[model samples]
Target: MSSFDLRLLLDPPRYPANRYAPLADRIKRLLATHANVVFVQAEAILALEAVAISIARPGRVAVNVVTSPYGAWFGTWLSRGGAGVHQVSAAPGQPIDAAAVSACLERLPQVDIIAAVHAESSNGALNPLAELAALARSRDALFVVDAVASVGGHPIDFDQHGIDIAVIGAQKALAGPAGVSGVAVSARAWAHIAASPDVAPSSLSLMDLKRNWLERGRLALPGMPPPLEFWALEAALDRVEAEGIEHVIARHRQAARASRAGLRALGIEPWIARDEAASALVTSAPVPTGVDAHTLIADAARMGVELAPGYGEIEGRLVRLDHTGTRAKFDAVLANVTAYGTALERQRVDVDIGAAARAVNDVYAAR
Candidate 1:
């Protein structure tokens, strides 16, 4: 390629300041949200942390659900604000139990906020968002969601589900860049945040964000907005609109189903037995007894297939075959299962690679 092309790659044109508002509008469409959506210049974590710091305060009690490290982090943030946090946790590689969460909330009549992650990429588990939201409704608590991993892979109707606050990233199923993210804030949530003594005019403050960027006509970000992340995010939005959001969701769902069938052909059952409880972005299976997940992951990588080991507490206990974003295709699914089978066979475990590949092919074909 010429230097002109290289320069274009190396030094992209300035992203239009006028287009920032439209980007937030597109995000609203993507999220199926009726709330005021704020475009955050940093990663989804920034938006998530902003919610925690801006709203938490003394005398506020929240029922924070814990399924992965991210959920635990949110609880910690809530506590740093001097709020009393009651965590309802689930075991490794499992989704948060809705009944358990309801029970916990019932014990605490003073609860004013309910926090939960919509889906945990770490454990490959999808929580019951509606149930959690209902619990919040019953208690009249602010319902905040860490929807980073589930936004595009699953249907998250923010308004329909009564979500007070939600954070999203484009890097996962949206196939966008990593640096930029968005957050949807409801009117009720905004009022509660304004009442919080913890609220201050900081970069992490949603109050500052709304007062500066969002309210100022979304003209230009306070700092020099990154051109590359913004432009890539716009292109991602274009792709999602062209494909239709429903189709994008269906693509991930089909990928997960195919992964499950292929893993079964290789004689490994999926970690989460039910389809609803599992994440569509990745399919996780238990590593056979005495078989190391990291070793299998390395072996699969040698075969040109990228496999992920379970996060944190479940590390080395499960192998995750990700079909996230562009990888949610038939070829990628086939390669993932076949490579895993090859690795298992190398470890002296019997596996039918051909059968696994065929299983993936058949599933996609049938769909």
Candidate 2:
């Protein structure tokens, strides 16, 4: 490799401590929280695991809300840490209902922790966060939300909702690098983590991060930080601030509305039928009769459009389309919808591609 390439990849200096604080502060601003924020030098799953490790232990009762596989993983992580976990699971490809969560809290008043995913991209479903958070508060339980996919696309008021721990990633609506993540911990959540004897000094320990935050401050990171990811996150935040967070959210909403309408016009209704239950970032639609999801996806790809299939068990049954961050634009929406409609036409499925494209443009123009 050339010297320039080597210098760019390996010779970069360690990031300054002052540089670190601004990133964390920007992330805190994005979360709309005054809670303690810690930037983890790994993917979001690690930060999420740290939250689970900090709270799960014997005698602690946790209610895990399962809308998708990520929720199931949270319950498993808590269980492995010896917490008594009761999972409130929704039907496959469906968002968890607030009623189900309320019932769980009512039946198990001893529940001290409530965990849920705010929006699941895998199934394109959005859980009732404010309702669930209210229930958690009424039950005096600490509410933990995985807002990885919802952060920029949806409005999240961590303090208003009484969410004790909110974990977010850069790869989704933020349109940033995936190598780093952050978590906002409320005072109550920190207290629990600080008091928990099960909380260790491992990489997945929130208490350790807390200690690092206190001693090193924002200028200094705990360990060797991924400078590249940190810089990427900072750039992404700059773009978000430039566009205004609320406008970004509105764009995402419009994208979701247009995408769903276009898909319906192409004879494929979104999987999350209800508007309230659908996620702004992702829209999953059922595979039409006599057409496999893989075939449909391949057809779209041949038209220069890439589409994601349903995750895990739901694979082959649904086609997943994303409209988050940079993708939440008129051109991107029009392109994806046109590609899908064209693909269906290739399969001899009748669809008005022009009309579908017009629908997307109309929504963009309306807003």
Highest-lDDT candidate: 1
Q: Which portions of model 2 miss their true places by more than 4 Å?
A: 1-10
Candidate 1: worst-modelled 10 consecutive residues by lDDT: 1-10
Candidate 1 lDDT over 52-168, as tens digits, reads 998899999988999988989999999998889999999888998899998997788698999999987776899999999998999999999988888789999999999999999
Q: Give the distance in Å from residue 213's predicted Cα in candidate 2 to where it truly belongs.
A: 2.0
Report the poorest 10 consecutive residues by lDDT, candidate 2.
Answer: 1-10
The runs of at least 3 residues in candidate 1 whose Cα sits more than 4 Å from the true structure, single-residue gaps closed, are 1-6
Residue 48 in model 2: shift from native, Å? 0.9
lDDT of 2 by residue, 76-107 (tens): 99998889999999988899888988887888
